[model samples]
Target: MQPGIHPAYRPVVFRDKVGGLAFLTRSTATSDRTVEWEDGNTYPVIDVEISSASHPFYTGQSRVLDTAGRVEQFRRRYGDRH
Candidate 1:
């Protein structure tokens, strides 16, 4: 509990460009750009590449790697000689 030693806590808007999701939260992060929120108030806008909306795990669409096919391909290419 120090005086004026901690970063200023304020509301910031995080905008997910890919998912088109915007959220307002309190944090020390700031941005030069500002955007008018749905609450009729302006907050610092911070753009992010990935968010929960577009994330595979969060969206419940897990990415599946082609492990079996890749292994077979690798065996055909290298394992046969060995």
Candidate 2:
């Protein structure tokens, strides 16, 4: 509750680059860029590379790791006893 010691927390817009999704949330983060929100006022625009909209796990686009190939490669390279 100390004045001037805390950063200002207000509504900010986070834009996901890949999915082109945006959402408003309260944050202390600030930016020089501004955009007119749906509520009709300018707010700081924060650009993010990944969000739930575009994330592999959330979007069900998750990739399977090539564990078998990696294990074979590791055995060929270092698992052999000299």
Candidate 3:
């Protein structure tokens, strides 16, 4: 790797809005906001809408779509005249 050619890889805090969870990880992304972590250190904070904590697949809270009902409704509205 060329020196001074790569972005900085530093620790950042990703905060999940829905679950109110924060985690520290290294990323190339940067944020203006800072947060105090559990280790008594301040790091840049990035707010995310969804993460594994509140994700349906990870949390096993899948939502079933009513496709059959929607199809029946569509057929009733524009079905062949019989």
Ranking by lDDT: 2, 3, 1
Clashing pairs in 2: none
- Identify the candidate with maximal lDDT: 2
Over 1-82, each residue of candidate 2 has an lDDT whose tens digit, in order, gives 9899999999999999899999999999999999899999999999999999999999999999999999999998899776
Provide the TM-score for each candidate, comma-separated: 0.75, 0.78, 0.76
Off by over 4 Å in 1: 66-82
Q: Which candidate tops TM-score?
A: 2
Model 3 TM-score?
Answer: 0.76
Model 1: clashing residue pairs? none
Task: Indicate whether candidate 2 or candidate 3 has the larger lDDT.
Answer: 2
Error of 2 at 46 (Å): 0.5
Q: Write the per-residue lDDT of candidate 3 for residues 13-34, one digit (tens) a residue.
A: 9999998878999999999999
- Residue 16, model 3, lDDT: 99
Error of 1 at 47 (Å): 0.6
What lDDT would candidate 1 get against the real structure? 0.93
Candidate lDDT values, in order = 0.93, 0.96, 0.94
List where candidate 2 sits over 4 angstroms from the true fold.
68-82
